[model samples]
Target chain A: MSLVVIGTVAFDAIETPFGKTDKIVGGAATYASLAASYFYDKVKIVAVVGDDFHKEDIADFKNHGIGVEGLQIKEGEKSFFWAGKYHNDMNSRDTLITELNVLADFDPIIPDSYQDCEYLMLGNLTPQVQRTTIERLKNRPKLIVMDTMNFWMDIAMDDLKQTIKLVDVLTINDSEARQLSGEYSLVKAANKILQMGPKYLIIKKGEHGALLFHEDLVFSAPALPLAEVFDPTGAGDTFAGGFIGYMAKVGTVNFNNMKNAIIFGSALASFCVEKFGTEKIRNLSSEEVSARVQQFVGLSSFVIGQ
Target chain B: MSLVVIGTVAFDAIETPFGKTDKIVGGAATYASLAASYFYDKVKIVAVVGDDFHKEDIADFKNHGIGVEGLQIKEGEKSFFWAGKYHNDMNSRDTLITELNVLADFDPIIPDSYQDCEYLMLGNLTPQVQRTTIERLKNRPKLIVMDTMNFWMDIAMDDLKQTIKLVDVLTINDSEARQLSGEYSLVKAANKILQMGPKYLIIKKGEHGALLFHEDLVFSAPALPLAEVFDPTGAGDTFAGGFIGYMAKVGTVNFNNMKNAIIFGSALASFCVEKFGTEKIRNLSSEEVSARVQQFVGLSSFVIGQ
Candidate 1:
């Protein structure tokens, strides 16, 4: 069994208060698969890139034991490239450029070997494509987690709703959850969205941390507070990747497992933000990850005598 | 030993998206003392009210086994009255009126009976007044937790710093922390603020939750996600009250105890926002508080196999 992550594997130019990067390696699938590889060995990626994508970049995934059989590289077309500048706060950013080169009419092709996928992570993409990927799979994965943003909801509400109904878990930021449910209260927002489709909802609050809601149960994960957030790019995707990757490793689907998964995911995402793009997350040691997870444990653990 | 809370004991007219209230019995000392009463029995108040404050309002404290000896009534004068309206999100508010009648020349009178104070909670008040309260104590309290706001940092920064130096723990919202430290990063802000004097600092993030920072240790407390927030006024004071109250009960001052105190405080603050002013917190049973605390424990608890 394997964990299949499907999203864009392209280039990004990012600028933050600390510094700026020039077209570094970045993408939803790249970060997600790299994060997942830390926890689970059977991690595979299905993404569309272009000739501009270097072989060394693809080799990084192989070095981490991440499968690249489904990573499509177009012969002549350039890859999708995005450039954005983050304000001093690092919470808000302005998109300077978005060149959807090879991603415009790209089709996700799941290789035959990926048929044994037990966990599927659908990163931000067109709702139709997300749904199509699910339908095309020979057998449905044991768990499906989908992450989307406000952009899709703004233009494709109908399609978004349809795709949302197919996932086992849905993850979105606090603002997107508010925007999607039209409720100012996150608890109310979670309740409304739970009825729309997914059995569980994970509302990512960035620096504030993340919340996991399943049925009548809710789990709050604390974010590791850092003196400085170097770059927040791909933190969300990395979080989702780590979450499902942990789940696949455990081979169980329950509220308890999901809670631990969130902490593990938060630990990974914490590392993702310490440097530009995937620089911090690409070369993590197991000891470093475990130590960071322990930091989270210490960050929120408290005992009260009854 | 007693927990003496010093601040305004006046009237407030609050308006939220849910509804609005007339001039109700709302004040910093009132909320803090009432919340502290649940955890510690020897809770007292030191504040100046006016003739407009009804006998029943004073009875409310007595009913909770709180000492009112230090509560001085200024005859023929109106109690400090504040009117504010919360925005739709309930995070921001606009102050419509601030009538500091009796509170303008407020003198916190520490009663002889309250001389045994061991845990002092200086609710939101003038920096000079908070310092005065500390000075008036014959012996230094084992734990001093001061709650301040951006207003003091704006106009009386020098006085604020002097007062902050006297407290063991300082609690302020995120924005106030940023404004006082001139640092956008909370971790950086906490470090700067801690250097000023306080051994510990808490940056409250309303719906996001609260963080407790000490030396190099940090504890993140999860805020109960509510379906509706009837009113947010006095929630912070209530939190401070619960925190110091728990400390007094435990008779300990350590990071572990502080973490639990924050959770207990958060549970009380959660009840505070469920209704306007102190309606919900004023009458909470011990069983109810315990159940709420347990909910908090369950909300953030997770175990990972080593």
Candidate 2:
């Protein structure tokens, strides 16, 4: 049972209040796969990069025991590059550039070895692309979690809703949930989104926290309030990675296990924002992860009767 | 051990998107004492109102098992009246009228029968009055929880700071904590505010939740995502009352008890926002309160490695 991640693996230039970074290795798959590597082995990546992508970074994937057989390398083309500036609050950002050179006409290639996929994570991408990958899978994964954004809801909502119907879980930020459901109240929004297709809906509220709603039950996970958020570029992807990674490790798709997954996901996302890009999530030890999980337990646990 | 609440007991005209009310029985002391009375049997309210205050409204406090001996009733003066309109988001409001009638020359009088104060809640009043109540107590209470707003921080900084030093716990909203500490980050803001005097700090973030910070530990409580927020006027005061009231009932002030207190506080605040002014909190059953508390448990509780 292996986990498969599909998204862009490209370059990004990020500017936060603390500082700025030049063109650095960043993408939905890079952050997601890196976070997943800490929990599960034999993780496969199905993404497209260009010649501009560094060989050392490719080696870094091997270093983390991530399978790259499906990581298609386009010949003699620029990699997808994005540039954004985070405001002082770090909650909002202004997109400065979007150079989708290699990704514009990309095709997702599922490797023969990736047929053993038991868990699938469709990161932020074009709805048609995500749908294509889902259709390409020979055997449907045990659990499929898809993360999308308001951008798709704005542009390709029909296709997005079509893709959303194929997944078991849908994860999006709070406002995106509002935009998708056209309801300001998150509970109401979750109800409407759940009706669209997904059995479970996770509403990520950035710094506020994340909420998981499965039918009538709801669970809230708090974002660890940091002294300073160095960068928030990959935090959401990291959260999604940790979630599906934990699920793959536990080998269950039940609500109880999903609760723990959220804790682990929130823990990983907390670490992701402490540094620029994927710097903080790249080198987490098992001991550090366990300790961070314990911090979440400490941060949230309370006994009422005693 | 008794719980003492001190703030205003007057009339308010509130306008919200859901609805509006004219000259309803509302005030910090009114809401706080009512919420506290549900937890602690001996709840005393020390507030001033005028003859215009309904005789039936004063009797309503007695019906809630609240002691009103210290509620000074002035002759011929109008009760304090405030009029406010909530914005679309319900997170902000515009104060249309503030008539400080009976409260203008208010002198908090501690009733001779209420000397056994073990838990004192200074509920969003003039810092001078809060400090005077502290000085008038023959024996210092075991726990003193003070609730203040940005309004006081703006008009009475020195008095606010001086009174802040005298409390065991300080409850303020998120922005108020930032305003008091001159820090944008809540973790940094909490650290600076903790240095100012209070041993424990509760930063209430309406709609998001509340955060409990004591020394090096932090716990977050999520607000129940309601379909609609009818009014948000006295929710903060009601939260503080439930917190201190639970602390008094449990007869402890430790972190574990404080965690449950926050849950209870958040639950009461949740009810407060469901109706205009103090309507929802006027009559709540123990079963309803328990069920609400259990909803908080379900909303926030998660188990790992069961």
Candidate 3:
């Protein structure tokens, strides 16, 4: 009924062909909380931010039924800052700058008020921090879905592997799947990664699509072919939010139900990329999100042998 | 309804990690006819062979429903011979030898008995030859689906372009899609190719899957992941064969109908690579194919909230 998302709640300056944005409200917790809150009425965000991070940003999440009591504000410290530019294609991007600031010494502390959440979403973060949050949980959540990237993979593989072993599901892109599993084909990669610990593996292929693999079952969902993908940052986290959020609401762990959750995640992620940072996803209404999900359902549905 | 397929019917020696096959039956028409015959009862093939071509090779296409009538035999000449070695991946291969024996300067003349065929498949071949067959047709068949490769793309760009203008559908792989459209993104590639004349464009991604792009609508069919893929030769043509053949059987040409056709085509192609050349697909029965189609249906199906 509730989710506790542990990740960045910071500022991002993003540049895209469509336009440029000054430091706007962006972060894993920011995006994920907004996406998940659409389906799950209660969301608790546990993250650290600089004093400069706007209180209005906190208000935004609070308005969406997300509790910000666990988001720590470090005195005189700037928030985690990221600046990135998207290429013309928008599938791949180049990070221009990253200022760790308050995030450099982030010590996530789950507040007592948020301990009742039943679902967990660990956005791309340090493996150690992800593991610590899980150990601190008062009770085992119904499900834990975590997203990790190649950054921690290169430097903290040992920690990453340990962290991966604890989660119910793992989300990694195609290249990460290959990098982690050393398998060129994703089918092989999923099989190898599933052995690493997670019960389910979702291989996100950016503009191409995403794959859901559990044991012998596999489901593929294609990205909406939008005319423009202004910025891709946080699309994956937003997808994670939408996925866990929907699952929290539906309260189903069946593969058939999870399949719907992935599509919902994909729908939210599609909206996130259409604008810089989380601008497009921030104000997206449930009706709009539901409409996009329906479109994806339409795009994915086709009768065969009829 | 019956169909006519015209292309090389030849001998192939292939080496793969799974095992090696001595000179085995292969070629566009060989794979295409066998795959297409799965849908329609009778399929007549027009091709030329030489003294070296075996009687069993000729008998291979003799009907359970398929009839080999236009196969012209030339004495004192060798049959079209090809030898290739498949890599461990099976997606790439190196041609060890190519001896275009009686196929050199050969002319294809459809037998009078095969003229009444309602469907036609112009498998990958010389662009001029494909055009010539169309010119010789007594009446335009119900529908024509053509498959061509990148080799002709370099040598006969003009002829291929002209031939493309006449075909109802064109099937090519990702690289060919990029090369033909001069775009890296497949969506952009399909948009440009759709303007060239073919109402439908299917881009094959080998083991990944296939994309059916018509205007802005793109339907992706995930390939059935197999633990082993011995050889990938003829998979694309086999996909095309199943596609057009199923359509001809159902007698419809809508977006929804073609969607099923792509799945049927993908199912047939998935089996083609399980053995060397056409061996795996040769003895394939409708029951096995039905099971695979059900798997495809299961793999791509999902539900979304309204």
Candidate 3 docks at the CAPRI level of acceptable
* lDDT for each residue of candidate 1 in B1-306, tens digit (9 for 90 to 100): 899999889899999888899999999999999999999999999999989899998998999999999999989999999999999989899999999999899888788898899999999999999999999999999999999999898899999999998899999999999999999999999999999999999999999899999999999999998998889999999999999999999998999999999999999999999899989988898999999999999999999889
Q: In candidate 2 chain A, where is summed lDDT lowest over 10 consecutive residues?
A: A297-306
TM-score-based ranking: 1, 2, 3
lDDT of 2 by residue, B15-35 (tens): 998888889999999999999
TM-score (chain B) of candidate 3: 0.96
Q: What TM-score would each prediction reach against the true structure?
A: 0.99, 0.98, 0.94
Q: What's the distance in Å from true for residue A180, model 3?
A: 2.4
By DockQ, the best candidate is 1
TM accuracy, model 1: 0.99
Per-candidate DockQ versus the true complex? 0.94, 0.81, 0.48
**Maximum-TM-score candidate:** 1
Q: In candidate 1, which residue pairs clash? A: none
Error of 3 at B166 (Å): 0.6
At residue A217, candidate 3 shows an lDDT of 94
